[model samples]
Target: MIQDITTSIRTTVVLWLLTALIYPLLILVIGQGIFPAQANGSLIVNDQGQVIGSTLIGQAFSSEEYFWSRPSAVDYSIGEAAAPTGLSGATNLAPSNPDLLALTEERAEILQAANIAPTADLLYSSGSGLDPHISPASAIAQIDRIAAVRNLSLDDLQTLITQNTEGRFLGIFGEPAVNTVTLNLSLDQR
Candidate 1:
């Protein structure tokens, strides 16, 4: 019985080392070696080399000069106010919910006032509320406003949109998306 107990304890220790320490360390080494950018949170930097934000997460852009990201339930607070609540989730509001309806209507009105078409993406927040990508149509709808605000030509804005548009995943899964964070950074560069 003592020998059996010793064997079980040794097995547990070995398993714990393999699963908790060795496996994670191996994965970290592999990830850092092969996919450093992605493994490092896909962070974006500015011209001065200051880390701005991550392409994996969305940010709130309220200025008319820049294209807006998807509506965030948490307002894309990031490390500001949302730090306490953790990150990335939906409001889980049902379609029939009155608050959701009011919010949607308000968003639609804002788009209409701007003379921009209220596409589905513009009117509703994404499921994660942290999506950094907006639909191509949504991007296009706001081009005129951005061009007018930035004093840029419509053609140039259109070209920028085309350049920043991302292709569908694996050429089949998921729809094509435009990364708003990258797009905004590119605009700043230009």
Candidate 2:
């Protein structure tokens, strides 16, 4: 009985130290050394060195002159949260839910008011509610509005969008998408 108890305690302690201490320390060391920028949250900076947002996260841009992120479940005035999937959650509403329909209608009206064609991406919340990218088709649909509002040529805006769009991983995985915050930033720098 005594030997069994001693062996059990030793096993528990060994596993605890390995998992709770050494494992995390090892991962942190490897992460910091191998990918310092990403380890530091993939933050982005501007010309004056001010931290703006991150490449891996989304932010809301409702201004006519800027492109907007997909509708976030976590709605707020400042718009989308900056941190990767920060404070995100789905409304978990079923497709036929009346509240969902109402919200979609409201969003459609808002887009119509701006003369922008509303797409599914505009009406639905992303699974993560923090997706940093949107379908290229969705981005394209808003080009006219952005062009008119920014007083920039449609050709230029389309070119800019094309430049920022990314193909799927290894050119064959998911559909092409455009980073919302990055596109807006690129627009500003131009």
Model 2 misplaced stretches (Cα beyond 4 Å): 76-86
Where does candidate 1 clash, by residue pair?
Answer: none
lDDT of 2 at 90: 77
Q: What is the per-residue lDDT of model 2 for residues 1-190, given as tens digits with 9 covering 90 to 100?
A: 9999999999999999999999999999999999989999889998889998888777878888898778988762243453553486778999999999999999999988987788888778888777788888888888988888789998898888898898999989998889888899999988
Q: Pick the candidate with the highest lDDT.
A: 1
Q: How many backbone collisions does model 2 have?
A: 0
User: Against the hidden reference, what TM-scores do the models get?
Assistant: 0.93, 0.86
For candidate 2, the per-residue lDDT at 128 reads 72
